[model samples]
Target chain A: MGVQDAEPLDVERIREDFPILDREVGEGTDLVYLDNGATSQTPESVVETMSEYYRTYNANVHRGIHRLSQEASIAYEDAHDRVAEFIGASGGREEVAFTKNTTESMNVVAYAWGLSELGPGDEVVLTQMEHHAALVTWQQIAKKTGAEVKFIRVTDDGYLDLDHARELITDDTEMVSVVHVSNTLGTVNPVSELADLAHDHDALFFVDGAQAVPNRPVDVEAIDADFYAFSGHKMCGPTGVGVLYGKRHLLEEMDPYLFGGMMIKKVTFEESKWNDLPWKFEAGTPPIAEGIGLHAAVDYLESIGMDRIQRHEERIVEYAYDRLTDHDDVTVFGPPGDDRVGLVSFDLDGVHPHDVSQILDEHGVAVRAGDHCTQPLHDVLGVSATTRASFYLYNTREEVDALVEAVDAARELFAV
Target chain B: MVGSDMYRQQILDHYRNPRNHGELEDPTFSHVGENPMCGDEITMDVELAEDGETIERVAFRGEGCAISQAAASMLSERLPGKTLSELREMDRDDVLDMLGVDISPMRIKCAVLAEKVAQDGAEIYLGEKDLDRTSTE
Candidate 1:
């Protein structure tokens, strides 16, 4: 509650690594980007790595016998290894599959596992705070399979109601999927405990780690997650690439999500045998350049420890929370504690989030204002929308000050 | 001072004291609409005159940003005595012109939500469309 210690991150030097941080928006105003939760700006190392790949050996992976193809394939495969190691997936590349984004990763599992396994009267346990990616996917799958989808209630203070989860994950629960961190509330759910509960119920544990893998230290094996999914764009990596880590046995047992050129072992006119793990799921040409960029992104994140980055975000979020809550007209949502992720969702007393966001944009401070792809959670919070300012390793206290000032400007304009 | 350019004086005034802001007791046509992207919602209710052609009374109830609520208020103030055909003819430009401000492309849906609801209500009332609600996504 008092002035905390300074974060142990050289944010200024880190800022220099991101060139766009030096750019301006709206008539020479410096950009105070607080939309990291949506998509993080790629650092120079990642951009350069992708550029180098394209500038040199650019070819289709896993097919050609030529030198360039071999180089591309090796780099692409190494990208999978890099991701697996970063997330502490002991099965390594054999268990990690590349998808377009976290949404695609969830879909892969839903198609390969959910459609095949879920049946009438079965249940899929999910959290109310889940993004539409996991929520809608499982919902539609349940509808198709005649399976029921139940939600774990979110507490008033923005936490997973573990008691509700315990009640929901009973004998008939087929899958228990939840977000490791709530994108809207920044509430870090107790995923390991949830995973253990799912395991006890004989349900497959799936984690939507889109917000968590990039912010904090994640060990898929340690958490004993059956499947963990995260996006590249949220971790200072390039778009069009994401990683899904599944336990080796589960992934090997599941059917292929897609079928095409590279994922088959032997194709006849009537039948086809699928390739080994991972490639069996990734159909056609993979995101070669984006995958390499993500490898570089992982390298960059590792260079600056994830623990330090987490601490830095905590400091910045705490500062923003303190500054914004200082005003009588502002109301911050989520948990009133220090253990949240590096973001804050709040509402102005009379102003709408869209208007508040427009005002913030005018002041060159970018924040997300909407349901944040969690409409059900917003309903639970009793708000149609909320203004969210998400932080990252590069975000600074000065940027938080700018966000508060811009919010003040919005409140003043609507005060009359 | 910063966001005043977008939230003009007229827009702010209408937003603060919206005109005809409530549900009509007995209305000929009522339609609910929303901009799902930003979660802005508006419900429009209209009472037709004795002739059953002109708008005898109009009221709206909803929650949204300054641009959306103000535009709804401004549109409600201009709805009396207008025929269903005229209401259906009203478009995005008419709503923007009523607000007297440049709505950014992102917030244009917010600025035109009420118009969509009112126009859709008139269309449904005239049996031109078989839709219950409208959305400016």
Candidate 2:
């Protein structure tokens, strides 16, 4: 899919692929689902792929020489190839390691890399807008290794303070991990520039692509990231399956995250040798059926084209940002322009976010209301919580209008 | 207008025009309870003349969702001249029953916010703190 030749996203056609979109919530009210940032609705094809995998090839891979094992192994390895190509990883299929979710992927990096390399007098640079998964894992590694974790401050408008980021990345910095797109504020950080800066400092750059991979086109090779992590559920695939992409050289250098049966090449009473790049990271029996579903999800996204998905979400975000900003009582928090994903965080005057969400729910609109697991960013914004409404290809402009009307109704009813 | 059935008429009436939605001056006993998850802050005050263990005067001031604000207004109306023991004996079910409609389980906290504040105020009025006052236990 070339940039100029990308076909425009057909929302109605896409919505038809998701059966849950047709169901009504309360008293024949249409379900206006705007919570795609939390978890996307899987298409029928992806669901059917998982069902087909279980019904057909229900056997363990890499152990048995039987026909079922061979079929399962081929399916599992094919899924890895699809995912590797999806993310634009330079290495071949062996570089992609399956994990439980993005959180586990990040923990693998922190434990395998951070625990081994970082020690006393070492520093790790992070950002204020990171989800707790990235923040807590690094914090734990820093505490255990007697290293210090520093943060790059975020401005009130939710852009990264690049000057602070540059100042934080010094010679002592050993690793720099940041979110590609903020889950709370929806600000798209400049990962390529940050990656360059980390390379300049001789530090490894790990990009938390959990939020970015679902909404935009992610090319890890273009960004030159050392490690990239994303979850399948957030990308319209099933839960309990995620990908951890690493450069071949860095992956070979790092130790295995888990010591188990499948991760070992050969085990003796005294010594054990770990397997190659991906198998070393993936211990025990993996989520084989989930992997097949994720391959279907990747195919679904590719059929629609990620560039078109970005443009489609950009249009909706621009419209929603304008509508939200036009309201006198609304206080929007995030990037002022359309340089972000479809996630929008805002607060209405004198109304709590929970109250706003409840009122919207009464109107058959769904949204998320909380700190969004970005407490440090919330502290920087000086607000406790905000109501978030994220969009996807299945969302229509009419849903945006409905959200606006419901928000106005909530404000009028609360009189705040 | 929201449905009168979903939100009871009294609840909407109180939410639209609350009775006590401002701070009290030198309240005899006051405390602030906040839902950090949603940033809803409730500062309740209780002025008790206390005619033989009876709450002579009870009032509250806070900002929250409709359910919380309506519950506070109704509690203010019901607690004045009620006995301290009676207020302490109040349960979440009693608060929801007063709302005149059943609410989702998640919103039970909103319905009980005022009752908890009143109980805390009653405990302060009796000069007791850091003690469990819930009737369920």
Per lDDT, the best of the predicted structures is: 1
Which stretches in model 1 have alpha-carbon errors above 4 Å?
Answer: A1-7, B1-3, B48-52
TM-scores of all models? 0.96, 0.91
Residue A210 in candidate 1, Cα distance off native in Å:
0.5
lDDT of 2 by residue, B23-132 (tens): 66656667666555555566677766636466655566766677878888888778777777998999988998888887877777777877887787678667787643
Taking the true A–B contacts (Cα pairs closer than 8 Å), what share appears in each candidate?
A: 0.89, 0.57
lDDT by residue (A1-416, candidate 1, tens digit) is 22133348998999999999999996789999999999999999999999999999999998899999999999999999999999999888999999999999999999999999999989999999999999999999999999999999998888888998999999999899999998999999999999899999899999999999887889999999999999999999999998889999999999999899889999999999999988998999989999999999999999998888877888788888889999888888888738788999999998999889999998999999999999988889999899999999999999999999899898888886
Report the Cα lDDT for residue B40, model 1: 79
* Every model: iRMSD: 1.6, 2.7
- When candidate 1 is compared with the true two-chain complex, its DockQ is 0.73
lDDT of candidate 2 over A4-78, digit per residue (tens)? 455678899899999999888788788999998889999999999999989988898778899999999888888
Interface RMSD of 2: 2.7
